[model samples]
Target: MSWQTWRTALISAAATALVVGLLTDTGQPTHPTTVAQASPPASGPGTNHAIDDPLTSERTRAWREDRFGMFIHFGVYSHLEGEYTRPDGTVCRDAEWIKRQCRIPQAEYERFAAEFNPAEFDAEAIARTAKEAGQRYIVITSKHHDGYALWPTKVNRWNLRDHSSFDKNRDILAELKAATERHGIKLGFYYSIWDWNDPDAVHPSTFGRYKERMYAQLKELVDNYQPSVFWFDGEWSTDRPSNPWLTQDGEALEAYVRTLDPKIVVNNRVGKRRLVDGDTGTPEQTIPAEPVSGQLWESCMTLNGSWGYAKWDNRWKSPADLTRNLISIAGRGGNYLLNVGPDARGRIPAESVDRLRAMGSWLVRNRQADAVHGAGTPGIVAEPDWGSVSRKGDTLYASVYRWPGAGGSLTLKALSGFDVRSARVLGSTQRVAVSRSGDTVTLTPSGAPTNDIATVIAIGVAPPAPAAIGTGTGLKAEFWANRKPGGTPTVTRTDPLVNYNWKYQGSPDPTILYSGFSGRWTGFVQPRFSERYTLTTLTSNTVRLWVDDKLVVDNWQDHGPLLSSVAVDLQAGKRHKIRLDFRKESNEAVAKLLWSSPNTPEQVIPTTQLYPA
Candidate 1:
């Protein structure tokens, strides 16, 4: 059924239940009907112990209480400002486009290493700003898809040190670690598993060898950094013909990381597909309507349009918007990792700083209402007009998003079952009157709140029960039309091709190519996809997918060089025409397509679903 139809059915079911509840009196006690009474608030020494266990609930509590944090996306790409430059210094169309797009040889692109200097970067300043802005932790990009290591690594010399001119020896990760430690803030790192520069890395055709290399590097990073959290990206490489590596060993990777440090929080990327160990990393600008149960989750978003420093991307969110988002996430028992992109000189944009400062001020006044032990109450519905409500021991904090219309009374159906000792607006100590009836608790304030945004109402209760998990099934994906026509019939050319290059205008745009070839060709595809995908190649040629659309995979990169069938989802009983569009060319060409699914236990094969092309 369609989403709209499902939603209508759900609404109808809820309305029916509400009517039934109102009609049945059945001599049931109006209040305190259950044999159990609310437990008294746990106090003092035991409070810490009660929260010591780092379960999903405890983590959610800690995150909600944090209220504010910082996100940093910095790497060699910062030097290019999202675009690459030619040898003579002409700015390429897609600067941060990746290595292959520049079409420069490996030696030439490596030449950029000499100029990769972030002279003005100050780790201490960044940490101090975050602390002052009321942030409790900081997450930075330790590495990106380009494969340039921000920290010193023994595995490869193509890191910040040997390749870059900027105090190449300095360790950015170590310095940031020390800075955050001194400032009493937790530190996390974003690591990309897919490497564009590493020929041994996973591409479309080579599965076994690539997995070995990928795991080795991950182990090295985890051992060295001991990061509080590991944000993994680039799990999918199936789209590019050059990428021969395709293996779903996420469970194994997660188990390995946990053995190293059980406390280390790993995102959903480490699991099959993008599923990580701890929680799903829902990108910024998107909020799930319902929460995911039996799993830890967080929403990572940017304060502005871009995650990295983009000079022209000035769209910034106000402090109020940021605070509302935080409260919403917390109310739903989730965390928000707000991000910021620093300039090449390593300076946090002034506008971002100002907005953070504003949030810091508001947090100070409302800290108690958001302390670490509080969890939201169950059976309470939040309306956009009314706002969110959270619960502490015996107190319920109702955060009003806007003033009520006409009457200023706040109503809650779950409150009728409990006795309210007192009610008061947060930031003020004055008590307000609260009345409880069969299934309704009404709070009448003496006066209007002074705050323009959200106002919190604290309701004193006897005690609280554990939170109830929301009901929702697993995730699913719906396939639409392909970007390329006739599936870009794979073609094989005997003549040597100088280079296979493709240009991507922006980050995160899906690009696909169709080719019909059968040969063992060897070349390097440089350009890489920002987000990883499962790579599938149709031909016998050792194919590897690289960002900048380079052919990093060849006969050597492919193990067994297995040819697997492809599948695509179409209307159950309908025919549709296929089209292929080749936007750019690459030196290393292989016929392949990238695909991902939101569902598990079911793999969609594109070739199997193919009709006459």
Candidate 2:
């Protein structure tokens, strides 16, 4: 589905769930009490514990290096081909959610399950296609929101082996697992939290039972296939009114999954896709406007208009558009998980295969695969007007999406004093003429771009060594017991940064309760370059910030993760007094202070730039 529709559904679902009960529980303990909770090395929020988890960091790092993956959305709905004909001679068009959208009765939906025979399903062919697409991993729908399992699940009979005419012994998941292993491609599962067919999941009274089976199914997946990633979805109350999938439930499930496989990387969809929920944020269908703050993210988009097979929806994005999107996402430090919906016969659409092959061919011909594998947001210079820039160590890969006319030049301005050592186009022997005028560098290519999709220009630059750890002592934080900080402080400490997510924790200090607390941070913010910087604050409650004794941001009202910013001019090698006052009114708390300029990427105010006042 499109991101706009998903977001609209989320709002409606959240409202409906909130109306039913925001924190409804089924009398089950939400904690993994048997397992010890790991603490992050720093004083970050409890939500960020997974980000700094020592046990799984290496695995997470490895997954991040993969960069690009394929998402397969295949299920019983594929048989409908995004259409359901009614007895009245009318038709309903919807993909994946055809049953729900068409108002098909439960009996009718179940009856169709028996005829869901995917005779052409070839797991090795699918894996080979992904390999040839230059994709490092594949996340297939083990079970979508329809609650039909692809494997021969022992938890219930609502699975391929038991319900469908497909060979009982030939499990699609198992085949894909072995095939992915053989192809050296990591495999992952996309499991839905909401089960439309499960009676226990739909009714509030039997929700606890559903949770038990869900845990069992997840464990079964882990023990049987040993997937590298768990991409979850359908956690909201979009159709079901009494959805009891709360954040605490997600927390418990995450803990349980960790016990099952400590190396598996999970997406934030495990808990409303919050920053504090899981290992990475799952941005569906649309790439984020910027790199997500304080969390790693991946953008999952479909090859066509729908994630599931849609016979009529043929609005396929061009190969150039897709490749440019991948480069844009990589430039923003995110992975791209492109989706392909197989037909009822289990054959991937020829359009998708052709596009995937084209992308793979381009990457191979241009030798740009290495440039995208572990690339991140460029730190040497600002994003240029011509294209996006991704950084891997000191090397910058500038991907030109819009090629300039013949004899035209590509210019990069507002650089951060990085000395350009060399410039060359990838997959070509032509040398790129590089000239620098102060902070601006102009690159004149020897010839036109190698490919019309995107031309990769490799720039080798030398950045200066970072400042020492003790260059700044950080900001002084004063915590108060009440919502107002006028009274005597309850505790005092030095906080490295103004980033916190106190969702499952008590007060900032041990002296106060979780809610109704306040904090004041005072420091001197030092910039690395002189420019007009946008100082941003993301908070779940009231906050006010002052720089150089001038109040720039005065969002002194309660809110939920609202981002507010104000531009302020600051000079390099100068200290500006920065003061932020925050109040946690109630419930889950979060606060983050970030800054970005023409030359700097959006990031948290570093410890080295924050000196105690």
Candidate 3:
């Protein structure tokens, strides 16, 4: 019924995994188990060590502790409806709105430099408002998919300096950087790896020769701005198949970036297979069951439906929803990057600001519990229930979603190891009765409370070393082809071009799938292990498994992406036959399937089997 009820029930079900190290003797508090040691990466600058480095961990901690940050998406595409236009008058629909709105040719789009004056832009005011809203960082889009550079660059003339009317001399980035620094707020820059204007970046024709100019401009941004974080996006370019950005050369690009600023944090989108530095962006509404140990992750979400300001988009999240999401992310050891789309004039919409302000007020009232370094308690469990709990160290804050008309006693299980010092409603300090028996703790209100929403119950525990927090673990599976024993198998995608017109076919959902336009291709697998196994496909498209049965993956909901996987146990030492059935749905472009295992390199699915599949 209520969100609190649903959250509690979901968390309770997921808590089974957590119950392993928690059960112990009744009188003494149980100490959490030691987390497993992390292995080193197969290849990279920080090889053979934990992937989560000090800088990354520190950043993650700061982010989690900070609890809130601002995201700004402003670029040439903000003005242009589609992505970009070609030299010819014919517009590329792939560019989305940028291509649709900017009917002008390259020459005319270039002249937009003069008309790009954002007279109402106020960097100081924006920074101040963010501070008042209790935000700790400001991430701005320095360059988006449209390839229009916001700051002046020596690598190319397609920048605000040469084209904009803002004194043609003043740099928006420089001003924003200075203002943010003055306000004691960290600044981050969003740089898109896919640039339509750069010949070397991604294009169908010029296969080799990635523009050195692009790297030069990247160096300029790092050297000049010295951003704390380099948020990258748009890696899914149209030219991926032939010029796969994840090649050795692409890895070199990321290494080059780190060389420029070793302290700078980079997101997964920087590399072809998301190998740069951190976790892929998780949407806001989703929460992982286990903490991803030894990895830096942040959930980037919009306050409303869109990341950028859309005049017609009015959907907004409520204050309770925002605060609850923030708590949920923190509980799972992740940061929340809340987005705010400024208008064409570069001012944050007033409505968005008001909502953030409301959230800030709530945070101020509960600063101690929600502070960055606060300990995370196991989530409150509910069974078709009515409330939730927030725990920090010895105290548990129980929030009753609704006051049961009959006023029954509140039951909290799995809390018997600690002593219940007292219970009190948050707004008032009045103590309530708390009783513990075995694994359950019960709390009863002294009288009917005045609150409309939930009430709090604080349970104190005997001080001990806080449970050692675990990062996360990984799951691996192996598959073999045609009962082959020790034979090399080729793994190739049915659609190798990523033409943006292909569809996936398989059973069981794949952990990873490739989707893009232009670079339509399939992955060919060579098995590393020789064993008999089952193959499952996880997709919504019509796919025929050529290996055994002309098994169909899915034939319905052909337009949207779906996940399916095939799993068959195999014996070591064998060669086998493995083939995928793939076809394209109308207007659907691009498809990819990956076969992976513990022996395979992380994030990479081997195309050719080393052994028989």
Candidate 4:
């Protein structure tokens, strides 16, 4: 993404860069936590660029449907609850960062390991709560920054079973896995690659020893319990200069894990902010201010002021906020990993349970608004003095966040070209009356909203409006049999834009997925400003983009391409020359052209902005 995209996520930046930095360890808000936004990471996996096979596709597809999940942050920090009082008298507010904030000696901090005893930690109850709250998966911290493991491992003797006095013989992971399996709930583990307690964590020469320990632990966990998702963190201390080879080791571990279990889903934090081949982009405590597109992302956030348990940090987000955030993320085509930090006794807060159940009830009533198995993500529409609107296929859900008045109609400006079929209140059968006037579609519900929290009006849209026949109206793709463009092409076609995934199609448009097939697209792009623009190229095999005879992006590679961008300058209202080329060497094939300008949302260059040149 462009600079604006990263800066717009949330909060003030710290020593270590984060898209969303809610606060420093000092307990002060870095930026507004109400709503945070993040584009994709600087660079990582793009749309469906993974090594595609039957198993990989099946696992990722299932994971996508299981959009909602619960994130558990339980560790020794829960026992402290931010109770560290500094010498200057002020207490360190973030209990989870106690090691860093209190500056405790490593040997002294190791004592907290034995104090870990959570008899109230009922795995079955947690799984049931997630199921009740409409969540399909749960991820808990198997190991955290404190280097204390929640389960027994031969490689790491400083684990719950090895150090804890209460249940030194029991394995927390084994027990949790058993309980979740009983409830038919998917379970995962959060592994911290950075072990501060390890001498190798600081000593570069001994880093190899640390890597061995981490790999052994990871292998043991995976082999023992077939985990679905692996949430990796603490790969590097980006703020400080530690071991330089940590990232390489992280990459090696990811490769090794895939050999163990190809179906296991890994997050983007594996090698310091998605430096390795990972599945999902994990954004911490941030919601997109507006809708997001292109890449798949998940927002991992705490319900309250702190990530881990903080006895005094009870400032929880309201149920309305939580439920809206969930729906909002779903609408934008992402997942919400809502977090809950259990207390020392491993009991989830009753208040948190209440909020989750409330959201679950809402989900039950507005199942259509859940955005599951949807054809399209919600596009921002101008609904003047009205409510927000989200879409799934032909259905448009007008989210009733605020009422215009006691009895008033909603005017959707974006529904100008869309021929609406009918409108109805969610959970009700009666279709409401809809009227139109000069590109303004208005809807009036049969009666007042029954639910105070959020009411949704399901507007049925007719098929898309047909395009007018004319040149310079859309994109044109021409194919050639040879490596370079020569005489007349073998096949030619026009499309609204470039978006192809030959994995499902078996062959690209006007070309085959394998062998030497060259393709070219010629069009005119209308720029909005005389500023630098980012042209992102995502394709299988080799792909290149040229703007006005200048090669803006020459990203040619083998296999599924990572989303890469290049910058160029263009003036407002001016039609600039645009050309894109694609070459398919073997296997899967795809080609997508996306762009973003200063102040404009990143998007595929639409037909309105493209013309035959």
The candidate maximizing TM-score is 2
Model 3 scores what on Cα lDDT? 0.49
Model 4's lDDT to the true fold?
0.65
RMSD of 4: 11.4
Candidate 3 deviation (Cα RMSD): 18.0
Q: Whose TM-score is higher: candidate 3's or candidate 4's?
A: 4
The total number of steric clashes, by the backbone 3 Å criterion, in model 2 comes to 0
Return the TM-score for each candidate structure: 0.61, 0.82, 0.60, 0.70
| Number of the candidate with higher lDDT, 1 or 2 | 2
Q: How do the residues 453-542 of candidate 4 rate in per-residue lDDT, one tens digit apiece?
A: 678777788644333423347677787765566689867877567765433223433343234566788887876545556777767678
Over 242-262, each residue of candidate 3 has an lDDT whose tens digit, in order, gives: 223543344445556666776
TM-score quality measure for candidate 3: 0.60
Please report how far candidate 4 places residue 203 from its true position, in Å.
3.6
lDDT, each prediction = 0.50, 0.78, 0.49, 0.65
**Model 3, stretches more than 4 Å misplaced?**
1-56, 80-97, 100-113, 203-211, 237-243, 247-250, 272-281, 284-294, 366-416, 445-459, 463-613
Clashes of each: 83, 0, 97, 3
Candidate 2, position 428, lDDT? 84
Tens-digit per-residue lDDT, 53-108, candidate 1: 12233443455456456878876666656565566997543223334444544454
Off by over 4 Å in 2: 1-59, 89-91, 203-206, 240-263, 274-279, 289-294, 469-478, 486-499, 504-506, 509-511, 521-536, 545-553, 564-580, 593-613
Query: Looking at candidate 1, what is the lDDT of residue 166?
Result: 75
Name the weakest run of 10 consecutive residues (lDDT summed) in model 4: 32-41
